[model samples]
Each structure stands twice: as C-alpha cells, then as structure tokens.
Target: MIDSTISSFPLIGLVLLLGLAIGSFLNVVIHRIPRGESVVRPGSRCPACGHRVRPGDNIPVIGYLRLRGRCRDCGAAISRRYPLVEMLTGIIFVAIAIKSGLTIDAALEAIFASAMIALIFTDAREQLLPDVITCPLLLFTLLAAAWRGGWGEPVAYPFDLSLVFATESETGFPAMRAAIVGGLLIAAAVPSFWLIDRLDIFLFNKYHDWQTETDSTRQLTAEEETAIASYEHQDRRMKRLAMAIAIVSSLLWVTLALRLGNHDPLAWKGAWSGLTGAVTGALVGALPLWWLRTGYYLVRGVEGLGLGDVKLMAGIGAFLGWQGALCILLISSIAGSLVGLWMMRTSTARLATAIPFGCFLGSAALAMLLKQIIWLAA
Candidate 1:
C-alpha cells in the first residue's frame, strides 16, 4: 500500500504541472479571444513593449517569481492574474487527481474546470464570453457525454419524452429510439443556427448600421480592422462546422437505424443515452434563460442577458446534464444576488449595475463539478 501510494505521487505531480501549463495558455485565451486576436499566430509577448516573451521567462509561476512579476525586456509590471491562474489551475488539477484518480473522467473534469476558469476571468475582465470558447465547448461536451454513455444516470428528459419516444427493445435497450432522438436533436442544430443568425441580425444589425453610419467618415484603427476580420471569419467557420455536424450526425443515425433495425440494439445503447442526455441538457440549460431574456426585453425595454450567457449555459448543460445545469443556474442566481447586495452596501453600486453574471455561473459550475468529484470520492 505504501509503495502504491508513493508511486501515485509522480502521476499527481505531472497532472499538476500540465494543468499549470494549460492555465498559462488559458491566460492567453482569456486576453486575446475577446479582442479577436489569434491565440496561435503571435507568441506570448509583453503587452507593454510587444517584446516576445523569452522561453526562460515563461515557466508558469516560477518564471513570474524569477522575474519579480516584471517583463524582462521592458520592466513593466505583469498582472498578478497570470501566476494566480497558474497556481489555481495546478491546485485544482491536483485535487481532481486525488479525488478522481487519473481517469478519463478526471481528464474531462480538468478540461471543464479549466474552461470555467477562463470564462470566469474573461467575463470578469471584458464582460464578454467569446463564442470561440463556448461553441467548441458545447460541441465537446456533447461528444464527451456520448463517450461517457450518459451523465452517469438516467436523464429526466423534459416533457417526459423519454417515456413516450424512448421505447425499450426486447433486450431492454432503447438503442433505436435513443438514436432517433439524438439524431433529430443534432439535425435541429442546423435550423437553430439559422434562427440565431436571424435573431442577431434583427436585434443587433440596426445598432451596427448606426455605428457604421456615424463612423463613416472616421478611419478604423488597424486593430479594429483585424478584430472585425477575425470575428467574421470565426462566425463563418462556426456556422459551417455546425452544419457539418448536424448533417453528419443525422446521416450516422440513419445508417445505424437501417443496419441494426432491432437485432443488435444493445451495442450502442450507452452512446444513444449519452447523446440524449446531452441534447436534453442543452435545451434545459438554455431555454429558461432564453425565455427570461426575451420576456425581460419586452417588459423592461432592455436586454437582461447577453446571448453569450445563453450559449455558455448550453455548453454547461451539455457537460453536466439538465439536473446539473439547473443546479448551476439556481446557485449562480443566489450567488449573484448576494454579491450584488454586498456591492451595494460597500460602494455606490445600485440594483441596476451590470454585474458579470457569467463569472458567477462559471464559478457555480466549478463548485458543482468539485462537489461531484468529492461526492464520488467519499
């Protein structure tokens, strides 16, 4: 037992180190993604002087300590967030390793937690949640759910459709039904994307046009041009990707249904269950918020929630399933209210102050994730 315990230490240490490196990359993501800068093109550089960060000075927390939190070339002070993010990631990774013990679930949890950390910081700093992060995250979580066979339990599909649509086979498997449901859900993405695009055009295009008209005589800065180009490119890529996934998923389902019929439905049961859970979770997570946002806009004549928040919730739902997503919403709402009250008491903040609700949501999601890990460990 002693030897086994000691041997595991190396793996734990490695996980921690890898997490710190990921955190460094996340810092880059949090900073550049919202600004429409490519995370890959330019290497890490001193924002103050644009000097490339030297290899020796980029060693996570150690590098910060060695350089005394100042750029080597420009001597400009670095934000404390860099090292803090790294340390926090390292610690969280270690805790996950300890609790979940170097499993695939542990890896997925680490990835989810890292993304949450990035979202937390990015939203807090920029009041923006880039689709670059949330969209891919949503896709990944759906895929991961399928890979995991489901969110560890039977999904309580909204409207109790599972009972109506998810009929069991002779072998007690709902493989065909699950495949059909999941396929339909995936195919729905294509139309969903179209609807979202139309909504954006209806809601935001006028404001964009107004800005363009107002600034018609003014020259755009180089950075502004780059950001615009980046955003447009990303938007196109995401649309294409979503369409491709929807088509491919639908085709795959058809193939499976035709080939299997009822003979061998048991083989793919887990995958179908996972897809169903993920799809249902995404809907459960985003729909309530979307309804609230629409209602608030109609009544209050102001946008209550950014679309990014809705997308973020969808991703979270895909990862955690409907139950976890709803829990996150409830926890985040309570936490946001408490923070708002505290801010009002301490400063000049009012009830209407624009709070970064995404930060709270991300934090709540992380807390929920940790709680799950701890529960499993216990």
Candidate 2:
C-alpha cells in the first residue's frame, strides 16, 4: 500500500530538493521575465565566460558554494540573490508539505506564493511588474481560498462573515464590498487624469509635454523627430520598450480575466471574490494619487495606476475573492505608500514618478492571506 505520507524522511528530503531546484529556475525567471526575455531558450551560462552552466554546476545552493560564486571560465562573480531564492523555496516547500500533508490546495498555494515572491523580487529590482504573475495569482487564489474555507466565520458554504468581523455598523459583506467600490473608484480615476492631460496638451500646445516639456516636445516635425531620437539616445527607446511590455501584458491579462469573470463557476453564483479583491487592490493602490489629484490635477504623475498594478489587482481579484482582496488592499496601501515616500525622499526618484504599486500589493496580499489562514486554524 502506497501510504501517502510526505513527512517521511525520504519524501521530505525529496520535497526540499525539488523545491530548491525549482527555486533556482525561478531565479532565472525573476532576472529575465521583466525584460520580456526567455528563461528557457538559452540554458544557464556564466555571465563572464558565456559558458553554458554544466549540470554539476547547477545544483541550487550547493552548486553556488562549489563554484565559490564565480564562473569556471571567466572567474566572474555571481549574485547572492540566486542562493537566497533557492533556500527560500526549499524552506517554504517543506513548510507547505507539513501544512497541507500533500493536499491539492497546499500544492497550489505553495506554488502561487513562490510565483509572487519571484514577481516581487523582480519588480523591486528593475521596477518591472508584470500582469502575467498577477492574473494567474487572482484566479488560482480565489478557488484555493474558497476550497480551503479560509473565509472569516464561515456560515454558508460559499462564504459569510458579516457577523464575526462586524463593526457597530459595517458588516463583513460591506468590508468585502468596500474592496469593490474602491476598485471601481480607481479605474474611474486614472482615465480621468489621462483625459485631462490630453485636454491640456490640446488646449495649449505650449504645454507640449504637459508635465515637463523637453527638447523632443519642441521638435514637432518628422525631420526634427529623427534628429531628436538620435540626440535623445536611450531614454526614449527604453520608455518605448517599457510601454510595449506593459501594453502586451495588460491586454493578455484583461482578456483572460474577462473570460473567467464570465464563465468561472463561482462568478456565476455569488460575488466574484477574486475580481473584487483585485479591484480592491486597484483602488487602494490608486487612492493616494486620486486624492492628490483632486486638488492639484497632477497627482498620479504620467503613469496612472501603473499598468503593472492594474493587471496585478485584477489578477488578485481573480484569485483571492473580494474579502481577502480587501485585506490585501489595506495592507498594500499602508506598506506601498510608506515605501514610495521613503524611496522618493532617499533615492533619486523624482516627485510624481510612477512606481510598481502592484508589486507591493500583490506581495502584502499574499502574505496576509497566508497569515489569516494560519491564525484562524490556530
């Protein structure tokens, strides 16, 4: 009889080894995914020697130690991030095995959390947030959350907590509902800002760039644009690339979300929890900008709602349901805004610059959801 016991020494060891190996791959994704580059086409290679990493040199944490953090051919340095990520994955995988005892929900949550960690790390490093991570996160999480019955004070099979978490006036439903209202508010806010900016540009061509007119703005003719492109160099090109990536990711995510929203079994029954959570994240992430703009008109800077954040939240909604999403919204807002301000004040970040709010939101949301489940069980 193949007794299903994962805590057994052999099985536990295998899970750790598997996790560490996957984590090593995840590091590749974190590094290349943001650049919209392939993680698979080109196998691992030393940055200095351009030598494809040999199988012996590819064992997660052990390989790094064996190689002494240097490429065999070029003797170049390797990053600590690689080992850190690998170790993190190994530990988390073991923890999941213990918590879930080989359940489907445990398997799913563990992977989702790992994916988010990758996204968070990448976004933090390159300021590159992708909808790819967020979209899947939302859908999988919603199903996982419901199936696990992690919802607060569960009464009904689907979800109910208006009583346990109830305030003097507000109920669980409303708090859950707040995420929805907040998300819609955010969606409405960003387009309005874009509309106003467009109006300003049209009304006063003098306000060419609208935010800050550059030499490019002054160069209107095609002949002048070519000159400007040549003179402007990499800045324009990088912005264009960033924009292209953002657009592609957003379109792919929204298309998937709309389909799920229409056809997912849960969507047909009650409140679309994941959708709500995503919207809640959107609203919470966008709130400061929306508030700042109501008075000054230029609060959200150029990249309103950050394309990454939008898809990320929408993806969150798809995963965590409305209530868990609300938790994500509050947590992400408090955390992101604080970090944003710190980066602005301490770092070279300019005022009103667009940052990856979704990265923070996604991470915090995931952390909180995990915490709630554990605490409730305890």
Candidate 3:
C-alpha cells in the first residue's frame, strides 16, 4: 500500500513540472504527426506567423500565460489547446506519481499516460493513430515488463524467474535474454502489419466486385484507358510484393520467439509472463476489430474501421495485458456506440460517417487505469 498524500510539497512540485514538460512535447506530437511533419525539426513556431518561437515563449502553461495567449511575433491568438494539453498531462502525471510512487511502475504508468494523451488528441483531431507513436510505445512496454519482472537481478516481491528466456540462476543473463526477445517481438510488428494489410486486400477482392462508372456519358481516350489498366496491374503486383515481405517477416519472428522459448516453460517467470501477456493481449485486442472489419466489408462493402485502430489496440494490449485490453475495447465500443447514436439522432452524423474510434479507446483506457488504481488502493 502507498500513501497518496504528499508529505513533501517540493516532490509534488517536481512531479508536476515534469508532467508539464512532457505535455508540452505531446502538443508537438499532436500538431506535427498528422501533418507528416517532423516533430523535432523546424522547432516550435507560431502558427499564424512564420517566425520561430523563442525558448522562453515555449514554456508550457507559463509561456501561454506570459504571452497572454497571443503570439509575440504576430500577436495572433494562440490556441487554448496548447495550455490545456500541458495542464492535462501534468495532472495525469501527478496523479500517477501519487498513486504508484517513484518506482518502475510509476514510470511505466507515466509513459502510458503520455501515450494516451497523444493518441486521444491526435485521433480526435485527425482520426489517426500514428505508427511513430504506437510502435515505439509497444516496444517500451514490452521491455518495461521484462525489467519489472527481475530479468537481471532480483528487485521486488513479484519477481518471477520463470519468465526469463533462460534460468537466471544458471545463465546470469536473464534480463539480457528478455530484452533480446522483447526486441525481436517489437521487430515482428512490421511484418505482421504487412501481412494483415495483404490479407485485407485479398479479402476485399474476393468479396467485392468492382467496376468504375464508365463516365457512361463520356468515352475515354485509348491512352487513358490503357493508363488505368496499367495502374490496376501495378497495384496487384504491389500487393503481392507486400504479402511476400509479410511472410518472410512472420517466419523470422517465429523462429526467434521459438528459439527464445526453448528454455523451461514451467520455470517461466515474470519476464516470460509479460512477453506472453503482451503477445496474447495484442491478438485479443486486434482479432475482434479484424473480424468486424472483414464482416463489415463483406456485408456493407465498406471499411467500417481503419487499420490504424488495430495497431492502436495492439499497442494498448502490450502495455495493459489481455484482460485490460479487452476491458478497454468493451468500454470504447460502448462509448462510441452511444456517441454515434446521439450524433445520428441529432442529425450531426450519418451511418456512413467515420468516427474516431481510437479516441474512445484512449479515453477509456485512461479511465480504466484510474479505476484500477483506486480499487487497488481501497
């Protein structure tokens, strides 16, 4: 058990400061990622003016306050979103720190909070869950799991030596092995995504018959028709190439995972458990959406969800485990359905209107995490 009460105000202040800084960075990610812009380069700039923002002007909430919510160079009104994101991040970080304390779990939770904030804002604004964020997050959680499980040295009570790829007592490289295995798993995502995409394309072709409207009123030139045919042929070849890459990557990952799993299964400790949990969580989280996507296409001949949603779920599952992942799915679906229904009733949206499902997932996952923390504390 831990106390949420801050015995020292300075510690609380430091945690809040850290949170604000992370939130500031997240704002950059939200703004740049969807635009396919580099978050690191070009630095922060006033949206209304081309002038680069000064370091003093980029100081999170304080910067906004000092600037009076207006750009110094152009005097253009800055969006309230910037300060809001910074505050939200700081609050979430402070909450997690209070709940989890300054341990590995606290660090992990903070990372999770940052990811959720980024995903929520990005999805809400652009309906995208960028791979740049989700892919790295998945890798971080997998490695964190191994570290927390005592991969190299015994640290905590929940230590499980069985999770290591090799016997910790014998090999003395348990943490290293876990790290390598985790890395391999992370690398596997690229191929897995390619395979999933290829399968989707195949299913689409098999289930749907397609013919472009002949502009039935206008006859196409011979060259134009030939160009269209050539494009279709090239597209088919590209899909085939993608499928081949997926296959090779799948085989490579499987070989690595199997080689790692050759150690005693019964001795599986916290590290191994974390790896299995992540893999299982990813499948559990992704399969439902995949099924839904396929079914929707089969019946409606339209994609009801984006592939980005699937990757987002897999990333969430990697951090939260299968049970938590399932919980997030259920909650997000319910929330999305309710909101969708309301939108339709209010004439704000149509059945075919795309909803940002990733936003719902991010929000729901954060809420669930808070609930879990509260429940455990009680």
Candidate 4:
C-alpha cells in the first residue's frame, strides 16, 4: 500500500468535516430541486414558517443538535433526515478515503457518492430524480473515466493531470477521445430506450383495451375507466425527436473517430475496446429493468418502472462502468424486494404501490462502490 503520509484518523476527520459541509448544501438540493425551485437563489428557510435560516443556525449536524432538532425561530420540529444525510455523507467520504488513500479516485468517488446520497433521499421523498443532477453526473463520469483512463486502472500515486496528459499510454487515446466515445454511446443508448418505452406503453394500452373488451371478470373503477379512456402517451413525439437527435449525433461521432485513424503507434488502441465494454455494461444494466418493467406491466396492467429508473441506471453505467452497474442491480433488487415484501405485510403499501425504485438504485450503487473500497483495503 502506498503511504498517504497522513495519520488516518485526522485525515478522516478533516474529510468528515468537508463532507458535512457538502451535505448541508445537499439538504437544500433535495428539498428544492424536485419542486422546481432554485436551489441557489433562496437560502435555507424554515418549511413551516418560511423564516430564512440564520447562518449560526445552519451549521450542519451541530446546528440541529444545538437547536434540539427544531427551528430556532419557529421552534417547529425538524426532520431527522437533515442530520442523517450529513452524517451519512461524512461516513461515506471517510470510507472512500480510507479505501482509496487520498487518491484522485477517492475524491471523484466522494463527489459521486454525495450526488448519489442526494438522489437517494430526493427519490425516497418525492419519487422524482431531477435531471439537473443526473444529467451532469453522467457527463462528469465520462470525463472522469477519460481523465483516469478506464475503470479499475486509476492514475497512480503523486496524482497529476499533467502526467495524465503526458502519459497517453496510460489513458488510451486522449481524454478527449474517451469522452467522445462515452458520450456518444450514452446518447445513442438513452434515446433508443426512450423509444422502446413509448412503444411499450402503446402496446400496453392496446392490450388493456383488448382485455377489457373480452373479460367480464375484471371490474374497472370509475377512476380507472376514466384513466384508461384518457390515456394517450403524452411524450411520443418527444421520444421520436430525441431518437432522431441521438442517431445523428452517434453517426457523426463514428465518422469522426474513423477519420482520426491510427496516428500514434504508442497510443493505446484499446480505447474503442474500452468504450465497447462501457456500452455493453450500460446495456446490461438497463435492459434487465426494461424487461422487468415491461413484463410487470403485461401481468398487472400498470407501469412498474419509471423512466427515471432507466435513466438512472444508464448514468450508473457511464460512471461505474457496466460490471459495477450489474452489481448495483443485484444488490438493489435483493434489498428492494425484501423491503417491498415487508412493506406489503406491515404497512398500507399494497403490491401495486409504486415504490421509489430510483432511490434503491442510487443507494445500492453507492453501497457497492463503498464495498469496492472496503474490499480493496482488505
């Protein structure tokens, strides 16, 4: 193991502090973004009373503890989630640093982990994954992959971007090329899936109408009847438009890459090969959910997987590569299934209740990343 040259506890402490600060900002994001409010323009305010949080009272976990977990002005009880998010981020940051040892990979992991935390809570609370976060995350991860070369092979100790640029052999083609490939693949894949979703919905509607006509045993409520009668896929045109854009973008990229040719013998020719793996991983991560969603709809005549989940998995593939995405699916499925079954038995949640699946995916992916770090340390 490379000596990080700092005492572990102190370093962890410092990072924990940073994480708490970042987590405080994340609390605002989770609250505001889903509601389509600006996360920046409006400072933290009491939800109950609309009193802007005083700076002294806004100190992450400490503020909550000092105030006895209530608003300083209004004295309304605050949710425990504020402190929990801060503490969870702190712990995740510490774990990543311990596993990665002050490396760039650790820093990148910390950022991604923070975003994942925000996504988890936002989805859990609202069942919405804001594109504001997920879209940027996807783009950033592709760049990170380019900068770090491929997954599994992070730049070594004495981390330097100059060296990253100087040593082309390490990164495969340049960072620019890898970014192009990763971006292109993501673009093409996401829209294709969107089109598939539109088609699936159309078919589901047709199937439902057929069943309604033929089967007398199934009784439809007034609300259900109205919903089916009014149901038209609202975003069909949007999906078609997106698919066209993606197709053009993908073809342009392939043409550009092919034109670039083999200029440098020392350049790692495997950049394309690496991207192929990423594309495969992304597809592997997304397709299973699509199959499950479509299959569930056929059986139950209700939408199971939201489009948010499909997009989230695609982003996961771009960031973690495909294998990590598969691991996320496995872990999340087990966790969600267990929780879902428990909810069915113990709560008002029925089999048809739409659980926030994106929450599970985000949480599971972050967990697997942490586990990866722990396994590396072990």
Candidate 5:
C-alpha cells in the first residue's frame, strides 16, 4: 500500500503540470474573450509590438522568469498576471487532486476552480464577465449536478407540494414532483431574459453598451478602429452563442423532466433530485439580483448590476445549489462593501465609483468551494 501511494506522487505531479498549462490557456481566455478576439486562432504575441512569442518563451512561469518579465522583441514589460494565474491554477489543481484522489469529482471541481479563477481576474482587470465563460459554465454545472447525484446540499422547498402530486406508488411522488418542480422553475426563468432586455430598453431607451468608452472625442487610429469593429463582431457572436446555449439547456431540462415523470422514479431518483436542486438554485441565485437590478434602475435611473453578474450567480447556483449560492452572495456583498468603503476613504473617487462586484463574487465562490471540499475531506 505504501509503495502504491508513493507511485501516485508522479500522477499528482503530472496533474499539477497539466493545471499550469490550462492556466496559461485561461490567461488567453481572460484577455481575448473580453476583447472579442479568438483565443484559438492567434498564437501568443507581445501586446505592445505584435511579435509572436517564441516557443522557448511560452513556458508558463519559467518562461516569464526567463524573459525577465519583458517581451523579447520590444522589451515591453509583461504583466505579472501570467505567472500569477499559472501558479494559482497549479496550486488549486494539486490541492484538489490530493483531496479527491483523481476521481470524477476532482475533475469537475478543477473545472469549476479554473472558471472561477478566470472570472475573478477578468472581472478585476476589465470589469466585465463575458458570457462566453458563464453560459457554458451554467450548462456544465447543471450536467455535473445530474452526474454527481447532487451538489451535496439538497434543496429544501418551503412548502410540501408533494402531497398534491402524490400517486399510488410510494416512489412515484418524489420523481414526479421533482420533475414538475424543475420544469416549472426552468419555464419561469426562460422569460426572464426577454423581460430584462425589455426593461433595459424601457428604462434606458437603449441596450446597455458594455463597450462604451469615455474617450468619445479622441480620434481613432486605423488599427484601433479595426480592433473595435472586431470586438463588436465578436461580442455579437458571443451573445448569439449564449442565447443558443440558454435555449438548448432549458429545453433539455424540460424534456428530461417530462420523460422522468413517466418512468420509474426510483431508477432516476438521483438525477431528478439533482435536476430539481439545480433549477431551484439557478432561480434563487438569479431572481433576487434581477429584482435588485430592476428596482435600482427604477429608483436611481441607472443600472446597479450588470446582467453578467446575474448569469454568473446562476452558474454558481447550478454547481453549489441555492444554499451555497446565497452564501456566496452574502459573502461577496460584504467584501465588496468593505472594499468600497476603503476605496472611498483612500481615493478621490466618490460613491459612484464602479467596483468590480463579479470579482468579489468569483472570489467568494472559490473560497466556498474550497471550504466545502475541505469539510468533506475531513
């Protein structure tokens, strides 16, 4: 047993190395997704000089150290974010591996961790959470929940609606009820997107432009113009993709619920429970924020939270369930408030200063996930 344990060390090391590579790719995602650029097509290049990064100079943390934090071609200083993300991801992957022991749960957890890290950095630097990450993440979490039985915390409904749907068989009620509940929640949430869009148009007279900049008076260079056009095109494409994903996911949920309602409930009980929990979690996670966003706009005539945040929370809910989602919201809100207070005290910026709330949310979500993993291990 001891020899076998010793041999496993190499596997853990490999996982760590793979994580570092994934982190490098995540850096590409963080940078390009926000800019409406393709993460796959363009190879790594010096942002300042547009020179392709040489093969030897692209080795994660070591490459950054070898380059001395400067581009080889133009000598422009490279952002330390590269090494930081790579190291962080490697550490997270190693920790997950050690705790979960190369299981499917560990893989799922690693994916969640990587997405959270990307969102945390992307929101911190760009104040944007691209749908390209959150939308797919939402779908992944729902599927993961169904696969894993549940997120550990089973959702508790306030009232017992099972009585109304109870049938002759003892097991029939649970599966049928869960299916009905999940379907209803999914159906309710679908129209929210259209409603939010309509609200934005009604209140603001236009869709909220995330790409709007303050430098409207400046003359744009030809390159800058090209970049902006590319960004806009990519943004549109991403939105369409997000819509497609949302539609397909919702339809799958409803279809599965219908099918599950007719089958033997015992066979798919775990899946039904998981699907119900995920749907409830998504609604609980997103609706309150939507309410706050709408109320704030009505009262103040300005947007308080971005729609990306609502979607981000929904993804968190799909993974962690309603209880975890609420915990994340509470923790992030407190942290954001404290940071805003500190900023107000230290800087000249006023109350209207835009704080990256998604950064706080992402950080809280990661911490909560680690905490849960540790608790389960203990």
Candidate 6:
C-alpha cells in the first residue's frame, strides 16, 4: 500500500503553501470588501499608477519586499499594511492548519480570522465596520460549524480533539452545539460588559448621556450649527431607515441558510444562537453610542442604532446562531473597553469618549466562534 504517512506530509505542505498564497489575495479583499466592491472582477491594480499587477508582481510578502513596499509602475510608496496583512494571514492560516489539519472548518476558520482583521483595522482607520465581511463571517461560521464532518472512524477519547476528529464522522449536532455554545457565550458577554459600563457611568454621572462625557467627537462649532438647520427633521427618519437594513439582512440570511441546510426548527437552535449573540452584542455596543449620536443631533439626524451595525448584527446572529455569537460579543466588548481606556488615558484628558464598540463586537464574535472549535472535544 502507498505510505499514508509519507503522502500526508506532501498534502499538509501543499495546504500550508496554498494558505499563504490565499492570504495574499485576502489582503485585497480586506481593503475592498468594506467598500461594497466585488472581490473578483476588477483584478489587482496599483492605487497610485492604475497599472495592473502581473502574476509575478503579486507574490505575497516577497512581492512587497522586492518592490520596496511601493508600486513599481508609479514608484509610489505603499503602506506597510500590505506586507503585514499577508504575514498575519499566513501565520493564522498555518496556526489553524496545525490546530485542525485540512478540514473544511479549518479553512473556514482561517477565512473568518482574515475577515476580522480586515474589519477591525478598516474600522480603526475609518469609523466603520462594514456588514460585508461581518455578515459573511457569521453565516459561514454557523454553516461551517453545522455542516461539518471528519476524517475517520477511529477512537473517541476524553478531552482529545484528535480522537474526536477521527470518531466524529457524523455532522449536525456536535457542530450545532459548538456554534450554539459559542454564540451564547458572545451574547452573555456583551451585555455583561455593557452592564458594567452602565454601572460605572451611572455611578459617575447618572443623568448625563453615557458616551458624551467620554466621547471624543468634537462639539459643534458656530459654523456647524448653521449647517445643521439644512439637515432638519431627518435624523429620526434616518434611524427608522436604518431599521430596514437590519430587518432585510436578517431575513435574507435566515432564509438563505434554511434553504441550504434544509433543517427543521429544532435543528436551527444552534445556528440561531450565533444570530442571537450578534443582535445582543450590537445592541449592547451601539445603545450607548446611539444615545451619544442622538444627543449630538439634539433630536435630529440621530439614531438609536446605527442601521449598519444593527443589520450587521442580524447577519452575525444568522451565522453564529445564538450562544457562540454571544461569546464573540462579550470578548470583543472587554477588549474594546480596555483599549479605549488606554487610548483615552494616554492620548487625552477628555471627560467622555466615543469608543468604537463595533471593533470589539466583531473581534469578540470571532473569538467566541474559535473557542467553540477548541472546546468541541469537551
């Protein structure tokens, strides 16, 4: 018989290499996905020169280094972000491979992580965390978790994933459990963070808006107030408009997923958990921020929820189901709070801050999903 061990080595190496290559492509997706642009179609081009990048010129980390982090056609300097994205993706890919071998879930996990990197950094640069990546992430995380299988019919040992992988040939329930648990964790986490923040805010300034005292957004200057009159009674309408985004997106995902899985209501419990976590998280993260936004508008042009975030959470809920999504929500909140505090304490002596809770929410959701995989054996 062909040597199973020898054959496996080549396969593993090939997967790792392909993952690195894919990581390079993910860099482009990261930049463009948030803009609502097609990941395919346009192909690669230099932002400065508008010159198409040839196959040879697109060689991942090597390409950036050889070109000295600049576009060869335009000779314009490129930000180090490109190389960093490639490297980060490569590392995450390799790590996931080590964790789960060449399973579909592993591949999806890598993609999920890559998407988060894009979402987190993009939001950091511009105050936006697009539904594009987050939506896909939640859907795939749930589907991948639910529609999963394994390698062999070997043994099932306690607290050992290797054995679980071998024995867990069937799909459905186990993955469902993982997704449910993870999403629930995220759901529980976010409100807990908000509760704590609420407590802190209530303790310090009970009547003041939770975020304004801490918001970094500058006060309206005399000229800006004049501009506000032009917008008029639109803020309330905008909030209502934002509601449509969440409603439509959630329905679409739920329908799409049900059609694909052909599952029953009970079968949906696990998948639904991811969605629950996302919605819960979105509310927890956005409520205070929304209050801040509305507060600024003085009852105009302000919303209780950023339609984008609300819709995005619905997508998250669809993918993660309920439980696992919750974990993501919670973990993200903790991270964001810590980071915002550090930034605030070090950078400015402001009384209030406008922390980007979406950044934390996204990250926590991803974390919760990942933990589900690791804890599956348990």
Candidate 5, lDDT over the whole model? 0.74
TM-score of model number 6: 0.55
Cα lDDT listed for each candidate: 0.74, 0.55, 0.70, 0.67, 0.74, 0.51
lDDT of 5 by residue, 45-77 (tens): 999999999989999899999999999999999
Model 6 Cα shift for residue 303 (angstroms): 6.3
Q: If scored against the real structure, what TM-score would every candidate get?
A: 0.84, 0.59, 0.74, 0.73, 0.83, 0.55
**TM-score of model 4 (CA atoms):** 0.73
Candidate 1 residue runs with Cα over 4 Å from true position: 1-7, 150-161, 174-176, 187-194, 200-222, 242-267, 349-353, 372-378
lDDT (10s digit) by residue, model 4, range 109-160: 7888988999999888867665556655654454455435434443222322
Error of 4 at 363 (Å): 2.1
Q: What is the lDDT of residue 105 in candidate 3?
A: 77
Candidate 3 wrong stretches, greater than 4 Å: 1-6, 151-186, 205-268, 372-378
lDDT of 2 by residue, 1-378 (tens): 111456589888988998898899899888766545557869987766779998998999999999999888788899998999899788777766765566665577677768777877877676656444544444444344333433221112233332222243421233333233323432332333335446545643432331123334453777645543543343344344544544454444344434443444333222333333334433443444434433343543333444355445544543454555566777877886897788789977575545566577756755653663356457
Tens-digit lDDT track of model 3 for 1-378: 444655577998899999999999999989876555657788899888879999998998999999999999989999898999999999888778777677667778789889989999988886667656765565555556544543432223222223434555653334445545554564565557557767876877642111222134567777656654654454455445544553554354345445654464323345555665666677778889878877887898666887778878887776676777888999989989998888888874467635789999888778766774567657
Ranked candidates, highest lDDT first: 5, 1, 3, 4, 2, 6
> Which digits, one per residue and each the tens of the lDDT, describe model 1 over residues 28-63?
988887676778869999999999998999999999
How well does candidate 1 match the true structure in TM-score terms? 0.84
- Model 1 residue pairs with clashes: none
- Provide the lDDT at 273 for model 1: 62
Error of 5 at 104 (Å): 2.2
Report the lDDT of model 6 for residue 42: 93
lDDT of 5 at 364: 84
